[model samples]
Target: MSFDTPDDRKYLESHEWATTDEPIRIGISDFAQDELGDVVFVELPDEGDTISHDEPFGVVESIKAVSDLYAPVSGEIVAVNDALHDQPELVNEDPYGDGWLLEIDPSDESEFEELMDADEYEAQIA
Candidate 1:
């Protein structure tokens, strides 16, 4: 099956995607939500909380399984998508858009260079 892997972001091997823009946006890839089935809950760190790269920062629970959300870059969380509290299916409906999980002020922009590009990520998942 095919998955949406946008060229605008970098992806973790575990399926998280991170944008390079300021206040970097983070979210699971469409492949992740598809694999997870219907998302039922998302547990996220509050705004202002600091997260370390490659560390677990939150959790996403779906009908099929529960998964830990890892940090793609170390930084203070500037925003959290509270809409997911009541509309968890947004993760499935729009994993790259309204389904976004967090935004952070990156401590090291270099970390983005270490992540897989869309082509590499698509190859890995293939």
Candidate 2:
């Protein structure tokens, strides 16, 4: 199945994606949500919590399994998608939009350069 890997975001090898803009938004990629099947719950870090790059900041539980949601870069959590608490399927229905997990106030802009672009990420998943 084709995944929605938007050109505007950078991705992790493990299938999370993050916006490059300020207060960068972070979420699991379309590919990841599809693979996980229907999401049942999301456990996210509290606002103001600091998360390190490549570290687990939350968990996504699906019918298939529970997976750790990793931070794409070092940042403080500015916001989280509370909508997921009642409607986790948004992760499958609109991962890049309504399903977004966190907004980060990045600690290092340079860290974005270390992430994979859409093409690189597609190739890595291919």
Query: What are the models' TM-scores?
Result: 0.98, 0.98
Worst 10 residues of 1 by lDDT: 14-23
- Candidate 2 error regions (>4 Å): none
Model 2: per-residue Cα lDDT over 38-79, one tens digit each: 999999989999999999989999999999998899989899
Choose the strongest candidate by lDDT: 1
* RMSD (Å) per prediction: 0.5, 0.7
Q: Which one wins on TM-score?
A: 1
> Would you give me the overall lDDT of model 1?
0.95
- Each prediction's whole-model lDDT (CA): 0.95, 0.93
How far residue 61's Cα lies from its native spot in candidate 2, in Å, is 0.4
Which residue window of length 10 is worst by lDDT in model 2?
1-10
Q: Model 1: per-residue lDDT, tens digit, 1-126?
A: 999999999999989999988889999999999999999999999999999999999999999999999998899999999999999999999999999999999999889888999999999999
